[model samples]
Target: MTLAHRPGGHSAARRRALLGRATLTWPGLAYITAFMAVPVLLVLGFSFLTRGRFGGVVAPFTLDNFARAVEPVYLRIYAVSLLIAAATTALALLIGYPTAYAISRLPARWRTVALICIVLPFWTSFLIRTYAWILLLNSEGPVNRTLLEIGLIGAPLRLLYTPGAVIVGLLYAYLPLVVLPVYAALDRLDPLLREAAMNLGASRARTFWDITLPLTIPGALIGAIFVFVPSLGNFVVPELLGGGKTVMIGNLIRDQFLEARDWPFGAVLALMMIAVLLGAFAGQAAIARRINGTARA
Candidate 1:
């Protein structure tokens, strides 16, 4: 009998294909379930339970943890974290877009070199990088000494252990994240589109605003999320740069868990952070879909 003439042949093939696909995906699904989904569910469960007298979680559940997370002290920390994160994202966008644009416009042979320069810092440990910043931004560091010797200021400026230092640290660390995505977007863009716009009497600036910028919004948004999400929960940057003065939600969460031994409250803060990240991702996805639809139209 021919393959088509066999009654159950097509159905049997479809089943095999489905099974193959499932087999391929099982490892990833199992990893997520075992690590990500399970931990998140555990944190959610812990958020409701009472804190033990010493460290761990207790049996009886209560809403007090969530309620305490919204109090004035924690609210202030949230506000500060939001402001810092926003500033970091904005600065990264402004700086990274131009940088990515420049890199994208480079010769094909030179592009790889430029990209390597941008991402070279990632080869080192993040904690080591943060410590390097601490060295550069300290009162007696090279930055202040250079400025003093240059006669720009009377005395060495206190650059480290301040809010501005925290922002600087965040910007330095996350700038590469912004650049990579924007570069990818600009690199993939067809050169002919820009040429056609220019041929139609659109000025370079006008073409950028009308054609190039609009097309790269998705990439910019991706970079923004990359910087913003991590900046929001970053304790190390603020701790090392701000010198314990600037307390972000991340520091607060850490303190609750370790210092205070309040597991429930810490879990509550963690859940709040996760919720913010989820909301940001959802909003980005919705905006991306709208942009894609408009582009298609």
Candidate 2:
């Protein structure tokens, strides 16, 4: 009789625990559904629906926009955007990892201050930062004048409104994003493990390559996503810095909506961006699972 009563009591406790978890998760679920899920579904629905003679979407359904999106020219634009985004991610990683590691190794009292300094620029307007780059890279700007005075080049070199300038702006804007996650990972790492590796005669480089890098990959991957996504979808950088010559997918989308008055085409571009983001999410999940499996081992 006691055993029978014990099983029922345990079942009741399990139900209560499950209910508590559900209650805690409901708010977040609702928030995501309201903001993220709804917006995505709306875009998807709009992509299939026909566009009015003007820029607006009509109620009727069609696949004409998506069909057009697969054309060779649009496909090339997508490819270029992917390539640029990948390059930006790589550059951010190259700079951010070392910076994060350095910060993580700093005195405990200084770590917070260092991180705040890194993040301080983000609190300001993103457009303002990009505009500042425009001013610096302009033909008669301080950078050009200094280079000319130093005889580094014969002329201003037309540095502004070019692909290289766009890339430079991207790196400057997104460097902090990559650093923060990497710093978090390094901060959470067990210093004793690194010391143990050193004591076992592993060189510093070997320890970092074998132990530190593998452990820190999840955070690095997150940083890559953070940099890649925005760079891929960035309009301001291309507009202000690219001088309308370097046409990216983001610019194409803007033209479709504003100039061409093609809302359906814009929706299709939006869907493509969503697909890329989903792919990034899947990659992150895979990396995280691999990290967890290695931890278990």
Candidate 3:
């Protein structure tokens, strides 16, 4: 028999294929183990330990940090963080859905232009972008100057240091994330389905509600999760815009680690946040699997 018909040949081919996949994947696996897994394990270990005398942990390990984290004061911070994250996710979805749908409807050449506009903000530094918002929202900035010129308001208003400003910053920062995913979903949709609906006497709105919306729900959910998780843990926008007035879980964790010199408690907070992060990732995976399953069906 030819080599192709031999069992050893087939086994050898399988081995070569496995070896090639291993070669391709090992670098990524090694990076994750070194950076992500190892750091997470270190943080987990530190969470149960006692705080150090000066800055580092010298452990007669204890659960006090975890207990401290459940206190009412920190719970309020958690609540505020959740509220801000939810608001950001809602606003991103509200804006991103239509934006993505519009992009999907564009001519192929123009679609690229539209997407470039959507993500153009990313070309600049995030810190720089945040600072630019500060300048625009400041009392003497162009936003207020335009309002003054138009007689819209008597004053600049306290736009710089508030929860609303934080939300605005977050929405601006993460809006592209929502738009990209929703656009993918909309782009993948078969036009024939909408055509068939219209042919069957359904209106455009009805077709979108009945067909397009349901199909793209996975993408929307993925985008929402993407925006929500980061917004929840974000500290920078709240600090710069909220001006120390809006305190979230991220700020709390930062303070515990850097300011208060309580690494154990900080680790506890990080651990809690990591739990939420892991849950978000799991949900994202489930949505992806559902999308794949739907595509297969």
Candidate 4:
């Protein structure tokens, strides 16, 4: 019998194909379930439980942890962290958009070189990079010495261990994230669209403002989320740069767990962070879809 003429042949082949795909994916699925999924489930459970007298979680599940996280003190940290993240996102976009546009205008070979330079920082350890920033921004660092020599300031400015330093560090850390996505968007953009706009009497600036920027909004949003999400929860940059003065939600969560031994409250904070991350992602998706639909229309 021919393949088409054979009853149940299509179903049998489909089952085999599905089974083959499942076999291929099982290892990754098992790993994710075991490591990520199970841990998240545990955290969720812990969030609802009570903290033990010493450390660890206990029974007598209650909703008070979530309530405690909403107090004025914790809320202030959340606000500060959000504002810092917002500033970082804005600065990254302002800096990265121009940078990505410039790189997009470069020769293809040069574009690759520029991108490599943007991402080269990742090769080093993150902690090591943060420490490097501390060395550069410290009171006796080159930045202050240069300013002093140039008569900009008589004394060395306190650059390190300040909120501004933290912002700068976050910006330095996440700028590459912004650049790569924006560059990808600009790379995918058709040259013809810009040409057509110019052909129709649009100025170069007008062409970009009208056509280029709108189309690249999705990428910019993606980059913004990329920077904002991590910046919001980043304790390291703030710790190294802000010197414990600027307490972010991340630091608060860490202290609750390690110092206060309040695992339940820490889990609540973690859950809140996760929820915010999800919201950011969902909003990005919704905005991207809306922009895409608008572009198509």
TM, every model: 0.92, 0.88, 0.90, 0.95
lDDT of 1 at 79: 97
Residues 11-36, model 3: lDDT tens digits: 78889899999999999999999999
Ten residues in a row with the worst lDDT in model 1? Answer: 1-10
lDDT of each: 0.91, 0.88, 0.89, 0.91
What residue pairs clash in candidate 3, if any at all? none
Candidate 3: regions farther than 4 A off: 1-8, 281-297
- Predictions ranked by TM-score, top down? 4, 1, 3, 2
Query: In terms of TM-score, which candidate is strongest?
Result: 4
Q: Is candidate 3 or candidate 4 better by lDDT?
A: 4
- Candidate 2, which ten residues in sequence have the lowest lDDT sum? 1-10
Candidate 4 total steric clashes: 0
Task: List the candidate 2 regions with Cα displacement exceeding 4 Å.
Answer: 1-32
Cα RMSD (angstroms) for every candidate in the order listed: 2.2, 3.8, 2.7, 1.9
Go through the candidates in order and give the clash count of each. 0, 0, 0, 0
Off by over 4 Å in 1: 1-19
Q: Across residues 125-148, which tens digit of lDDT does each residue of candidate 1 receive?
A: 888888998889878999998998
Candidate 1, residue 228: how far the Cα is off, in Å: 0.7
| Model 4 segments more than 4 A misplaced | 1-12
* Whole-model alpha-carbon lDDT for candidate 2: 0.88
